[model samples]
Target: MKKTINSLKIPVVFLLLVSAFIACDKDYSVIESDVLGDENSDFTTGDSLWSVTAYNKKLDSLQINNLGTTSISATAGNLLGVFNDPSYGLTTASIVSQLVPSTFSPEFDENPVVDSVVLNIPYYNTVVSYDEDNNPEYRLDSLFGDNDTPIKLTIYRSNYFLRDFDPNNPENVSQKYYSNGSSTENSALNGTSVIKFDDHIDNISNPIYSNAAFKPSNLATITTVGDGDDEVATKSGPALRKLLDNDYWKSVIIDKEGDPVLSSQSNFKNYFRGLYFKAEANTNDGSMLLLNIAATAANITMYYTSGADGSRTQETYVMNFSGNILNTFVNDYSIPLYDGDKILGDNELHLKGTEGSMAVVEIFSGKVDCDGDGILDLDAIDCFKQNYRQLDDNGDYVKDPITNRYKLKKLINEAQLVLTELDNLPTGSVEDYHTYDRIYAYDIKGNSTTLDYSIDPTTNTSDPLNSKIISLGQRNDTGVFKIRLTQHLNNILFTDSIAENTPTTIGLVLSNNVNYTDNAEILDSGDTVTTVPRASILSPRGTIIYGSTQNTDPKKRLQLKIFSSEAKD
Candidate 1:
């Protein structure tokens, strides 16, 4: 055996040397290694699946005052009417706006007789076609709920004075008003008595105007001026044109022409206060309209004939809806309760517009075993330090001495927050009427856009509807929303203290326009949410989406998927 081993060693050595020469000479160009070597590899790419905690948060009240000199075009249209959503319940929208005389003082001719007073508020419409007589046909836009259904609309004289400056603040800060009429928080801040619904002038007994069944019409309004051959017909787009009681206008405006009440804008505002467009549900489901109350064409025109009997000429006195215009809302929906553990998130997210609910999304929530089952909850998976921390010889995370936290070093290529709509939503006439096409995401703590939104190159300033469309992947055909958070995620990962800035919760709500990023202050009991997206306040639609705690179908649950690469050690 010893001799055989010694003899075999020489043969084995000689054979290996011959085989090595043969292999070197043979063509092996097609053979490739699957593994990317450390020297050759710049980074190792993989997807980091992170759990998202999403839950519905109820909005108590939203700031609805269009403050200062802000034009109506710059903001969402004044919502007026009632909409009974099958999912969100009843929403009554009303407007209380100050009226300003076109001129401070008026010098009327002799025998000024008030004829007719008309209030004109234009509707958002598009010219569909024109008839042979050059009369245009219109289609109403921005109308929610059943357009055929009617809402009880009443226009009243508001007795409460909306101030320009806060009376309580010595610094002369602007006054802030909320959507709820019962909210006394703003009044408490200004040291003034709250203006309740019953405080309006002639609201019940003698409103300025009342419509038991008010439904919007898409037909153009045509009026004939003059008589016989001298008559000229003027046509305008669809509008809510109502003739007010002539005697009322005469007593309030025409009769007070030379009085001190009509001497200046401030004087007129104080004397008249404002007009309130109060909306109530005439039926279980009524119509809602986005009104252009501040449009140039929208005004109260008082037609009066002046001068002698022989030279009686029809003159006009115009009053504009100006100054502190406020939109009040009455939401009669059940508030979503957070009964489950917040760390595990909620089952469904309720996102409604106006004074409705919004979803709060937390990214990279730490591990939590809520059920005490010796296993981490799937919804509470921690993907922060566990994925990015450096491992030592014992495979334990290497911690920094100064911060006392695991060191994280990873390059985030892309991070997307995926939201899936609930597929089994109730399907019916009211339920399927209007579905929101877009949803906006913002930093709740900062009350501003994320870095990704700011850096998105597709932001079209000219067209707000198209702004950030790519980054904010709107609801696709499959009913899914994928919002890019690449820059936002990178910022958190690269921050000096990951634990301090790790959980950046985001707010998700339906937006009328994403480009309208201006935030309106929220009046609530706590200081948790100070403001919300103003675009959301303008919309009346709502939707339901899957949250994180839906365990049956994990794929439908909200998640943050990050395409990342490991940094060089």
Candidate 2:
């Protein structure tokens, strides 16, 4: 038989062509579309479908999965591929002709992003109303005795039917009455809420005792007024407490103009959006990033926005009193083609500085103008440079020190006065400490000097002339001592008169006197032996020289005694 070389060659050639066709089909799977099947055709792979098409569907699903987990960079070209809605119905399937380069471009997510940065500032003053009868027809009062009538202020999603009031019959709107202890059934209410009560009834009563009655003056609107609701004019819906929780509020300088002046100093301000620190490497180079505080105040705001590549990119941030970012940025916090910088995480600004693990960010160069003129701001004063007190007398950052000193002095003086009064009380009085004469004297130098008048005058050597008591001697523990009067007493010895005709040093002579330990004795020119006092003369003198016995004897058995009424030491 002729060896069939042609037949063998043909078979081999056919096999080679088949193998090439299979290999080409595998490569085409990468770019294959779902167009081959009818709209109702199951996307699920089955043995019945062409192998190439089935293989392509499997590859397509893997690509979709990979895209979901990948995070794109801000500077990267938009690589999201295809605007086909994952939620599209079968009827909306793309036509074969619609496939083109422009149509294949990735769709950017344009959903409105809410700025998480939110602040809740309470209206300074609050209000509430009460009804006495608890019924539709009853007397109402704002002043409910000394007891504080408690009320809850609620924030709501909208102004959905709070309650309708019939002024003619207030009981019709009794549902809106502030919940008090007696009205337990009316407590539940729907709205974001806050609560406060006067420690005692605020006494909003008119003392005139009029017959007129007052109910809650309608539901007080949220406001910043000293005596109003907690609503801000710009904010709608029920007043909420959760929103007020992390808001940074500045002192209202000229409060007369309705709204409270918002905090302008970024150093004192905070954005409390939800976020925290975790150890991570940078996207570009995987370098270690140190998280640290850049300023005293929690001023940073996290700028979160969607990138063109369908991934979120966040810029670590801080802002001043005004919505100005501290660190460098291509522009202000305003999002390009978006509303007030779509904040993420619930319209609440997260305070990264307070959390302590926040990453430190450099202030943007555009925000740091150094000519003493402001940066990126029309006014020379930067947002961070606002004077809270608004006083720039010396142009120094610190408010004037003069007022502080005066304030300190006034406080000290008030404290001293209070302490002085306290000292005068029984618990702290001088008598308690045995310092009766707590006369504190001040001299030219404001130094203190003390005098203890509680002591006897004779023992006190603090200058009796400078002292108050005129007497030199006082009754001592021992018997009294007497000196005979003489002209010399007036000069140097003894005399009854303060002035003497002539000066003389009179000699000392002891006058007859009663001894504390013995019977009385008398001294006379003839009776040196004390004959006058010898029993007979001791008798009551019957002789009446004047109205009674003269008893010329210096002492004739009479004893001298003194009684002191002062409580004994």
Candidate 3:
């Protein structure tokens, strides 16, 4: 946004802006201009492309979770599917701020309006500086500090970027970079030149405490309070406000409607870091826990390399997590950071060339310590279990299995038995998984020369085909199951090799020829033994047959038949 005061060139010069609207004829639509200074036009008629109050109001509309509620719905199950029920934790406002869409318009323009814009969002920080002796001194009220506490310096790093899109190219649309390298000027739009916001502080009653003061480099400036604003101390604590001059905190002003004042050294377009809010030891308290919440925004900076065709393109790194800070601290407080004190979160941004041209990739690789307990969230076993469920094979809920490998293996073995039918077979019970009954036909063999089962038999009336019919009662349920004693083999007997011996137990002597005496007798001998297989009525249903290769004889085959009982109703 740029502004300049110049001499009036023409008395009747008419400034016209073409806007899209429905035509009165209904058949055609076109861009038409309404006179800017027309007498009948409403004062608020023109589009408000760049307005600060409206923008600030929009920022204020972002929500936060408060501790005051009695009962709450699970945020993960309710809001955005992020937090789960038992793990009802959220990020601090700083972390949540990252979720704010980079391309959103606050102004309610009926039609799309394009305008260069600027906005300033405030933040608090704990400033540390060096004294003349090279010893570390602390400032608590610079742009990063709190004034009401014993802190001396407070400061903030403001993020700046373009808000509107370029009408010329679609790919160069409303994408926000940073204001680190821009040559834009820093001034205020309204004449008041001052903006104040709330920054919380802790007194002596708080858990943490500190009192220090120091200065900063030219990157920021501080303003003093004047005699007229003595009433500002009403809330700033009795001795707290008097420790510094009137302009203890600097007021950052960026002139939007004028030429850019930021020099190229600033690199506004590439400044992708986050605003870290450091606290003085005096104001430390439990505020560090506040930073651990997921509501806090994890800052991300996207890097890109422009393509040779004068268009933009993404690189091979589809995306990555840069780093995340709890936005809060815990346990101890000092002017500077320590090695083990900082808790970093995964928050790399997604960078892509043309490969990611389709849809944005959702890469999750960040951690949040919403409670600020010094322990990483992932390492907290209870916290992890509360937030995530154990998924079964069907993607349904199930109890979390024991972590011991042996215990898990046993449980898996038991689970597989539920899918088998051995429990319902003969002499079978649920607990009888290890039991087996008497073995029958343990050493059975098939006919060596034929695929079908056949037995050698008597040469005369007792046919080999009839002797081969060894009935084994099989309960089959496929279609209709009926038992039939049939000749299983095609041949009756061979010519010269075999014959039947005289039978001993004679029942009836009947012959076709009266002169000849021929009768068949039941024979009970060591070589001939028989057992009639039993069969009971089986209500018809479906059946499944399992055919397996004989384990004893590799070439032998066996089949199992299963039947479904008919419903008793």
Q: Which candidate is the best by lDDT?
A: 1
Candidate 3 lDDT by residue in tens digits, 240-263: 111211111111112211223222
The CA-based lDDT of model 3 is what? 0.18
- In the range 308-415, model 1's lDDT, one tens digit per residue, is 888899989999987888788776664443323466778888888887878888776766554558887544433354455556779776666885655555545557
Candidate 2 Cα errors over 4 Å, as ranges: 1-112, 120-303, 315-319, 322-569
lDDT measured at residue 130 in model 1 versus the true structure, 0 to 100: 87
Measured by TM-score, how close is model 2 to the native structure? Answer: 0.12
Error of 2 at 479 (Å): 46
Give the per-residue lDDT digits (tens) of candidate 2, residues 405-513.
1110000000000001111212121222211111111111111111111221222222212222211111112212111111111121111122333211111111111
Q: What is the lDDT of residue 316 in candidate 2?
A: 22
Full-model lDDT for every candidate: 0.72, 0.17, 0.18
lDDT of 1: 0.72
Q: What value does the lDDT take at residue 68 in candidate 1?
A: 22
- How do all the candidates rank in terms of lDDT, highest first? 1, 3, 2
Residue 394 alpha-carbon offset, candidate 2, angstroms: 49
